[model samples]
Target: MKVTILTLGSRGDVQPYIALAREMIKNGHEVVICTGATFQRFIEENKVSFYPASADLMALMESEEGRDILNGNGFSLLKIIKFSKEKIAPSYRKSMDDFYQASQGADLIIYHPKALGAVDIALYFNIPCICLPPVPIMYPITEFPNFSLSSKKSFGPVLNRLSYKLVKFSELPFIKEINDFRGKTLKSPKRKAGLYTYDINGSPIPIIYPISPFLFKKVDSWKDSVFISGFFFLDSEEETLPNEIENFLEKGKKPIVVSFSSMPLKNPSIFRKKLVQALKKTNNRAVVLTGTSGMRFNQEENILTVEKAPHRLLFKRAKGIIHHGGVGTMSEALLSGVPQIIIPFAVDQPFWANLLYKKGYSIKPLQEKNLEVFELVQALEQVGNKEYIENAQKIKNIIQSENGIHRAVKHIESVVDNIKKE
Candidate 1:
């Protein structure tokens, strides 16, 4: 069978789907991944076919406004909404056209929610399509609050309902706009200008959520169409650590790994200086990743600073991890059984940090605007507590025991089989 998968956003969003696509290929299915053009080389390196969407998005994201959004300040959501309104349609349409041409006889279409046109493209072709959630954006249960929206307080039944309406209402305009574009682009009268909302109890195709079930309160009434696949992680591209780093890990004191991940800080030099001061105060060995921010620190024997290292490999040897609470980073840290200190910047990061905190795997996240050296020191100290390590290990055991990729593949095959039966 031939399967086509579509996704969008940063590297965090694209990586897992690549893992799944490779798994599908191993199972004797032809697989193609359609995402940011920046990942074309990465996808090809993994032996999966690649389709280009928008390289411009990456360039736009590296600009001043993008850096601001990454730093958790100033019109981030509004800017994203505007970009989606102005740019997403044309890029999505072109991507769909490319997919349609490439996947002439494909068996299934799996897509991210951000790829608004894929659902219609699947509908137009009368093929089965599954939604692959990159984060906890859509809630399958009515009782749970949609995590996609920004809330000032802890979510409850009242808040859940309100969040549902607010999210659905906010999406209405873009849904109509995309539908209208699809109607015109495809020249099909069957396509209508409207948003499609799915209920907890009703969905034709399965929704695959690759999150550990232990993190959140589970709903008994969650629809059968919703499947929980433990976090999908692609094997590291850099499987080996630098010899010096490996040798350093072999030394007596366990090191704390600090990384901001792909998100660049606004004033990285100031952040770096503060971090170095805090690390010196703790007297702990540290490895810092300054991604594209060009943060340079005085070379010290105890501290190692580099531009990048594979999280999958590096986190395993670390005593603890300090990072912005990206879902992908959190997942890796959890799987590594290392306690984390999350300093959330923006978007769904705070949600992940809060969830990890509630589950006892990490401390409450330090807000970037209010961050201080003392707070970083406190969080680092908290991560060394035995109870947090014990809790993190328990969660890791649960995650490792689940066969995420196999379960996801099984669901996709079942959907394709059902389509064949129809």
Candidate 2:
């Protein structure tokens, strides 16, 4: 079977799908990844077909307007939509065109929420599509409020589920663009409503969420169509550390791995200075992963900075971690069995940070705006506490037992088999 996977956003968002695509190919299926043009080479390197589908989010994050959004404490739903519309305007046409062309002759399509247009594209082709989100935001969860809502406080289970309904309603504005694309670009009946959510067969698409159930309980409200596959990780081949990193690790106590993965800092100088001060105050050594920031720093005796490293391998050797709470990074930290100090920026980051804290594997996170040196030092110190280390090890065991990619592949094979029988 020919399988097409559509995804968007940062590397964190696209990386997992690539892993899934590779697995499908190993099982003797043709696989294609439709994402931003920036990842075209990376996708091809993995021996998967590549299709350009969105703007370079890293470029956007570095733009003045994008930096403002990231630096802001938080944004209301409308504000986020407004900023997103502006960013999506220039590339929206090209993205739709790319997805349409790439999806041709595919038997199945698995899509990220950012590529909602894929639903209609699949309908037009008379194929099945699965919704795959790294987070559980696609469906309402009575376990807690929707992570994007920015309130950690829960009113009740009813209100928790209602929060997701509000999030769904917010998409009403995008309906026109979705239907307009369908009408203008593809040969299909004009959608009656705005969003192309349902399949041509009038069934709710199956949704596969790749997150560990230990992190958050599955809600009883979801249907059988919704499946929670554990965290999908693409294991790397045995990686040798750089000579400098190897030397540093061999010399003293394992340094804390500090990274704010692709998050554009408004005042990078100030952020770095405070980070250095915190490390000094706590008298801890660190290896900072500065991804795409083009950030250069004069390394002190205690700190070493690099453009990148294998997080899965590096985190296990670290004393602990200090990072922006992107789920990809959080999963690595959990797997490493090290306490984390999260400095959340926005969106679902705060939710993940708070979840880890509640589970006793992390210290209370410091919001980006409130990231003072003293507070950072305090959080660093908390990582050394015995209880935090013990709790972290417990969570690690649970995550290591999960087989997310294998489970997702089994389900995908079932879908393909059913379609063939028809």
Candidate 3:
């Protein structure tokens, strides 16, 4: 089988899909990754075929409007919509054309939510497409409100379902633009904009959530086609830290690993200083993996700031992790069996952080907008809670034992086999 996976975003966003691609290749399937140029080397290094998309999300982040949108308010729905309408309009056609180019001979299409053109192209090819969300937000569940609009409070079954409807309704703002792409670019039917995601596709598309059931227990509310196939955790390569960082780690007692990967901050300097003061207050050292957060610092006594390093290596040796609550980071931190101190910025981050807090894996999350030194210090102090530690270890045991990639491969094959039979 030939599989084409369409995706975008930061390193964490694309890394898990690479794991999926490599697994499929090993299983004797031809796999191609269609994504931004920033990840070409990254995808090729893993020996997967690479197809570059026209627009790069990192370049989008580096754009003036992208920085303004991403920096302060932290990735709210409105912010995403606004940016998509204004900045992304010129490139929307190009992105869809690229997806079409990438899907020329694909037997199946696996897509991240960011790559919205996958469905239409899949239709053009008469192939089945799978929605592969980084978080558990693609489908509606009665157990909780939609991940995007969820708050700290549970709204019961009815309202929880309605929250999902609200997310669907939010899609209305983009319907006309998407329809234009379908009709003009793909020469496809003019799709009616529905108040939800699947409605936009006009059929029930299979969705597979690459998250552990330990984090989100299996729910009875989902349709048979929706699956929870554990996290698509990338294979780790053995890598040593820089000499200076290794020295710093060896000198200190498990320094805190602070990595706000690709999350823009309004005032990175203030955020950096706040973390420093809090770490000092808690008598901890740190290694800050500041990728695309635009934070830079002079060499400090106990903190090491670098553009990138292997989280697989660093998280295991860290005292704890302080990070933006991206699903990828959340998965890595959980795998390391360490507590997390989450600063939720936007999208499904709050939901993941809240779930972790509720499940006793992390301290309560702090608002990235209003984070103060004292509050961070408090969360740091809570990092050593006996219950959190035990629970983290328990979750680790569960995750370590999961073969998500193998299971996911089976699931995808099953879907394709069923579609072929139909």
lDDT by residue (1-422, candidate 1, tens digit) is 88888887777778889999989999999999877788888889888999877533555567676666555557567877776666655565566556555455777888876665676677667677887877766643445566666523447666665565543454454555555556666665543332444421234546788877555445543557577777887885546887777877887588999888777766777777778878888888998877865477787768888778888888978888988888888899988989888887677788888777876888878865657999888878887888988987888888888878888898788777876786
Q: What C-alpha lDDT does candidate 1 achieve relative to the native structure?
A: 0.73
lDDT of 3: 0.81
Name model 3 segments beyond 4 Å from true: 73-83, 166-177, 194-196, 199-203
In model 2, the clashing pairs are none
Task: For each candidate in turn, give its C-alpha RMSD to the true structure in angstroms.
Answer: 3.0, 2.7, 2.6
The stretch of ten residues in a row with the least summed lDDT in candidate 3 is 192-201
Worst 10 contiguous positions by lDDT, candidate 2: 191-200
Candidate 1 residue 241 Cα shift, in angstroms, is: 1.5
Q: After superposition, how far is residue 175 of candidate 2 from its true place, in Å?
A: 3.4
In terms of lDDT, which candidate is strongest?
3
lDDT of 3 by residue, 1-422 (tens): 99999997877679989999999999999999999898998889889999998768877877777887766446577877788877675565577788888999889999987786677788888888898887766677788888666656778988887776664554365567677778887887776554225733466788888888656664778757578888888875756777877888888688889888878777788888898899889988889998877688887878888888888788988888988888888888999998888998887788888888887888899986778899999989878778777877888889988878889999999889987887
**Candidate 2 per-residue C-alpha lDDT over 212-306 given as tens digits, one digit per residue, 9 for 90 to 100:** 86665646666575787788887767556788888889999989898888876656777788888988999999999887443568948799999
